[model samples]
Target: MNGLIGKKIGMTSVYDSTGKSVACTVIEAGPCVVTQVKTEQTDGYTALQLAYGDTKAKNTSKPLQGHFEKANTEPKHKLVEFRDFSIVEKAIGEIIKVDDVFNEGDMVHAVGVTKGKGFQGVVKRYGFAGVGGATHGQHNRQRAPGSMGASSYPSRVFKGKRLPGRTGGDNVKVKNLKVLKVFADQNLILIKGAIPGHKGAYVILEKK
Candidate 1:
């Protein structure tokens, strides 16, 4: 009710009412099955577990297979729980489609994992300008993180230094993205602007 599990399909440009081209991200939002319902009395919380994307039963764990069987549905690749779900009365195995939750012009928040950029330097990771030009013996120091800390005052690098190791692959939430279109027949929704994650990655779209 409050949100739905979705997958990032890709990006495309659509013309708005003003005939201006607007870039949008396409998402396959549900046809998700209600897999579990947790009540405050039972679990000390109210949430609805929704499952999306199909997977082979052989690839699914036995416990998960049994869980899906209880809902009268096949194994799913992604399962997300919506806390304080608005539709608490939805029976298990009820399908929540894109149109059932979102409408065109509605604002929503998209939560996803950003693309992973492994082992990057500060220049790429934190958008640090390279250390000056290639002159003055600064050949290898161009992309190096300059002046980490005072050598005498702080013998070691600070805990939260800007020096980069791993970059991205973070759980990110982009808020207030307007819904451009919703195709219930195809179970797809087009959202204005970009969201996190790569194509085919799972995303959660929450109504604002």
Candidate 2:
């Protein structure tokens, strides 16, 4: 379950060796520091707690400050756990880079929050075709979820019925994205296909 915490750097099209443009999402992966190493004997699970991104000491809490200090690193804005990291032997305070966990042509998955669309209607949220042939005052009820319930059947609208409500802003996982390129010098990674969330959104990438 080796993985890395990264940030979405936006999308771009890159040409492969065959000279065909391939759309990909650029990500800034780590040089993540191992903040804590959990073991089955002590924590009931095996996981590596990694920290990434620079942060001012004053902006971080005292508890987090002590944690980073134990690892002998500066305060990091993002902290993620990679459970059962089996790619290699990792020690406390060790550095793991993008290339260390992934390589070109490797199949991977990305997890992140989808872009929030805020409140939405059934037509846009659930792709409801909506009522048609505006008849019997149906014009105004086109998008409305017609009839809540039968007069005397269920006696109430059924729970979990699809209706107008908030859309997006959920955890989305895009699986089997190819590792298009890796820039170890700049700590940037290019993954094939679109990933959810806006630019600068935190993303978790793990090998499939």
Candidate 3:
């Protein structure tokens, strides 16, 4: 996939050319540096390793420091690779801007880790109907799972049964989102709709 790394800068609504309001995710996309280029004969695959977000030398370890040195650039907060660079032709230390690969009305995909909601209930996690009788005789059946297993027929809870436990904090991908705007001066690329993860979170943007 043709992609780049970016930071989510929160969401906002914007009016399109037709004066239609659209929800958009503001992202501080690349101006990423091409750290390394690998070819089939050398690395057995064609890819360009990109680095984004500057990090101080004091914060980076020696091995990572050397890696940045190989790129002849400062330490970066993240690194990712793209398979094809024929359209980019980026060299080591070459900067990649958001406008280089994305523009208004272009379809793109974003991948990010969703916000965590720890230890959810069956009703909240699996959308199961909770035990009823809120007024009759129920005391605390509102959020209970109620019947999980059969009485004597099944002594133990069945495996793979839908039950509430941990929730969210998972990798999620939002696909075919239209690029609403690309602010090259600010390195911001706005896409239509809400994206996974919170503001300032790292996300991967891929052209779809």
Index of the highest-TM-score prediction: 1
Q: Which prediction has the highest lDDT against the true structure?
A: 1
> In model 2, where do residues sit more than 4 Å from their true spots?
none
Error of 1 at 93 (Å): 1.3
lDDT, residue 75, candidate 1:
99
Tens digit per residue, CA lDDT, model 2, 70-112: 9999999999988888843677789999988888999998999
Off by over 4 Å in 1: none
Residue 148 local lDDT, model 1: 77
Residue 152 in candidate 2, Cα distance off native in Å? 1.9
Model with the higher lDDT, candidate 1 or 2: 1
Clashes of each: 0, 0, 0
Q: How far does residue 30 in candidate 1 sit from its true spot (Å)?
A: 1.0
What stretches of model 3 exceed 4 Å from their correct place? none
Q: lDDT of each prediction vs. the true structure?
A: 0.93, 0.90, 0.88
lDDT of 3 by residue, 1-208 (tens): 6778999989889987799998888999988888988888888878888899888999999998998998889999999888866554667878888888888889998999998899999998988788987999989888888887788888999899888899999999999999988899999998988899977889999998
Which ten-residue region of model 3 has the weakest summed lDDT? 84-93
For residues 79-169, write the lDDT of model 1, one tens digit per residue.
Answer: 9999998889898999988888899999999999999989998999999997888987778788877887787887998798788799999
Candidate 2: the clashing residue pairs are none
